[model samples]
Target: MSGFSSWSRRRRRAVIGGGVAIAVITGIGTYVASNDDLRPLKVDFVLGGGDDPTEYGKQLKIQGQFGGLAVAPDNTTYLFVEANDETVMWRRKPSGAIKRIQVAGMNASRATQAAVAPDGSIYLAAEDLWRVSPAGEATRVIERRGCGKANPLVATSISDFCGATVTGVTVDKAGTVYVGDQLIQTPPYGSYVHRLDGKSIELVAGRPAKDGESVRPSNPAVRKGYDPPAGTKAKDVVVPDVTRSGALAATKDGVYWNTGPGIVRINRDGTLSPFVARRSPGKISDPSGPFDTVGRALDAPVRSGTGGEPGDGLAAIPSRDEIYYSDEGTSHRPVLEGDFRWQGVESDAQKKLLDESKTGSLVHRVTDGKLAPVIAGVQAIATSKDSLYVAVTTDIKYRNTPENSATAVLRVQLPEKN
Candidate 1:
């Protein structure tokens, strides 16, 4: 009887245990199904060092100073890298070899921006827009042109300051390319967004101003671009400020970029509008236009004596519907070296933009109807299948100083199913 009773108790206990296990699993599944944070992406690895590097994505090793990172349609990450005293196209293969991809008929100098096409190719913006296929085929599109000395542009007194064109490049999912351009001379040719479709190129938005014709800005300094003080020249008075396009990213949803203290979105229909304007902690009247708050405050100007302009960084992860950006922390915040005077108009604008400044190098996201903080001090960002990469750059370097030798790529892993 005793043996039988003991066996009966053990069998009953096993049945209860199995029932509890099933109930617990069901509860956990229900929780995960409702909680997005439960499936968060973890930090994977930081790729930096010699030619042979760490593999974060299958068989892929990141090498060199990665300036622009583009994730191809096949989920392969390609970096427009600056190294070995020149710029080169670096792509990681499925078999884990890091190789330099030579695009025929194209040079890598001045390749500061890159974008990926829907068909697994890449475009680099330099002297011209160069397209390279996944199989190493190359073609040059949109021949870069600078307004000549006879273009009627008034030059600046800043020694050797001359005309410039083609600031950056971005491509939409439909294979349409957009080039950002501005006339750096007087008469202040306004910023432009030009469209390139196959064999055709034309202006889709932004009108480049003619002599004595520039868009008058609500900001006094910008208005001053059109009308300089009694004695100062326009080119000398109208310095590069926060109002120009910094970086760009595109999606089927729309094209997004940072102009000065604001985020500008261009729709497929070619409508250009400010999505969010950067706000400084000073001056109370809601910081202009239908704008959203950039959390770093007028953070850039408050930290005076800082190098670089504000809003110089931007990136996007289309699959996640998220765009990450940074404020170079100052708007039109100019740093003068050797024998420079503080002009009245410029100082007034800086004072207004920087008043009550809250300071920090911030990283923020634009998604849904919000521009919120994701990280701090991450001045630049890029994204691929299951990872996000961010880097911080200081404006301490002078012109063309590639000898800095810092080539670190920090990767953050996420629970990305794709």
Candidate 2:
């Protein structure tokens, strides 16, 4: 689940004390008051937390770290768990029966993300792409063809090759699969968006760059701003500055991904645009606004020493254009001036601050262009008809114990849309 290179860079500098100021400002009273609307959405623990992974009759216990999670239309839950040095898929049915799914011929441990199609088929992405049918049969749909020494600059198409790293995957209502690929190799070092329809794969946005070429344009033109002339080839009309961090979603309109600039949308016609604007570090402009306004704001220069908040898990609504995403807030970093160092009290404060930042992991809903925070401390999210399923870390400080190890899946009822 952690294949995004940008995420790895952010995790290195993540200090527990990063959210101390926010905690002090909000306090307990203000925090409670602000989240009053979320109180009615009851959070019921569905699974996890025990000494070991076991299934006894209708009850199941899951331990160790987990990756992606998805909920089928029938309310069946699928979870990827890493235990005993192997990755396995666990399926929990509506009747409370739990069983492990054997995804033959593939290393489930390397799966970075998962999505369930409307027909109840599960899609997994990693170095390759796979589909597990509702009847429990798994097939490798896309074979990972290494880039090798091939030159992306002269190559006309990437239909046969998979990206060096697959960070996110999602299935639309029509059963079409969309994949976000981050190619970190030398010749084609950039991000790409690909669509897999049946047996054909097409590059929708971004392109493999030449050596020393920039993939992210400082001022990327969006939609009509940079429309190709008559008869322009799809591969030649590249949309720059597009990137992803393990988050990708699709609606009837198009595909959405979290990038350094914010959430970007690639329309069905291959036109690129901005969905949400990044205002500052850990902040974003209101999602409900004119597209030109958001696009213009995104074209502005990014602030120094800060990459915009990149979303984590993403899930699209079944029959609606709405989407849900998780934001992992920035980690705290300390600046050293001269020889000044932290004292015992300061060290204790840092520890306390780190603990307080756990609440900063937030889930948000994007509906009718409005972005609303739904819950806190969520690591990943998946959606069903009337509920949102989330994987939440029970104890961020320690995961060595049964009570604290691994994340617990919780189901939260969704509020009626306006």
Candidate 3:
């Protein structure tokens, strides 16, 4: 089950062009408005769309599917692209010069995620954890070690180890590296978040389940389409599909990550708590102020039913204590197949759900315990001091076409705080 679970997760990541379709609302620039207070933001095309890699920086056209995005302190942008089965990191300086950096000794076909440290070091998370120095030197910081064959139902103890599957990576303002491990093959069969300082690795949040232990559901209700065998107790049934984690973002307080329904934080004090509550189905509204405590933030009825399942993308502005998250929405069937086209729908209800999922997929800004919609159809997002960068697919219906499947980055200016 563990091996099959790992393959299922990777297959989901391999699908391209799942972002919500971007619509141009105005002539000056592409402006998307969410609500009245959340003003319409103009999106400028940064770069993307080309047939060849050599033509990348020349005509502002880069070929390949977008993987991840990050911005350094000096406003330099790092865009990860999966081209020819290899992960390529493109660095865009303040002067707009684009340079491609590929880490040596890494597998070309792995789904690589990247995060930039304060000192400009790039951390890549694939099967293992690696650090690419500012000068383009790559070093394997953590090697992949499997837990071998251990039954998750009766394993007495699970070791704290970096396993074969790593879902996401991020660095905080203090230059600490945090990795999200799915721990699919490891005993206990759940997600774990690990923190790596200079010398040691610590399991900050989550752990392998002990013998005969059942992991609690993060959200209130069981997800749709999950059914257990007859007479199986809820506490005894383990579902590997919903027990995954991804997309880590760090702030001064701690690190925030996607745990299925919503985001949770591992605080500076070494405590785990909910940062954003699991969204309920209804109209969402903007709250006025930050919650007094983490518990209040978790329980407060700020709004719900806006963002999709947390973890599509997460970005943080440590200076402002603000975080941005993206949701690709939920679907009844697989959004993309081998050819990048939408899969066949089973029913009208499923088609309606798919159509509704497109609109529910959005990027939101979380500040002072309040969540507000920023834009629609964001695949990945990054932040600079003054702007927000988003990767999106221009046309959704025509994603099967190579030209229409190109991913583009857009820049949105941050509004002045009142």
Q: Which structure among the candidates has the greatest lDDT?
A: 3
Report lDDT (CA) for all predictions: 0.43, 0.50, 0.51
How high is the lDDT of residue 103 in model 1? Answer: 50
Better of 2 and 3 by TM-score: 2
Q: Which residue segments of model 2 deviate by more than 4 Å?
A: 1-37, 49-59, 108-110, 134-138, 143-145, 151-159, 209-217, 221-246, 279-311, 331-360, 393-404
Residue pairs whose backbone atoms clash in candidate 1:
41-414, 59-96, 242-260, 300-329, 300-330, 311-328
Deviating ranges (above 4 Å) for candidate 3: 1-40, 49-58, 109-112, 149-164, 216-244, 279-311, 331-361, 393-405
Q: Which of 2 and 3 is ahead in lDDT?
A: 3
Whichever of 1 and 2 has more lDDT, that candidate is 2
Best by TM-score: 2
Q: List the residue pairs that clash in candidate 2.
A: 16-354, 288-369
Better of 1 and 3 by TM-score: 3
| Per-residue C-alpha lDDT of model 3 across residues 146-253, encoded as one tens digit per residue | 556643223222333545466678887678788776656655666556677665666665544556544555322222102222332223222243233466887767
Clash counts for the predictions, in order: 6, 2, 1
Candidate 2: C-alpha RMSD to true structure equals: 10.3
Model 1: per-residue Cα lDDT over 1-418, one tens digit each: 1111123443322211110000011112222221123112122223332223444342233333445556554335565555455555666543434555655555445454567777878876554557778766767665544445533233222122224355567777677777655555533455545566655556544434445643345644443332223332222222234244535677776766554445556656654444454344343122111112333322212221255432244667676676666544432211111111111212332222222112224455556645433333332456553235644222324453442433333343322221
**Candidate 2 lDDT over residue span 1-418, tens digit each:** 1111123333321321111111100111222222223322233445553324464332344554555677875567887765555455777777666677655545534355678987888877755667777555777776556666764334334455643466678887677888776665544655566777665666666655445544443423222223323333334433333333535787777777654345666776666555555533344332221111122333322221234222256777655456666555432221111111111112332223223222324445566665554444445677664456766443435535322335445565443443
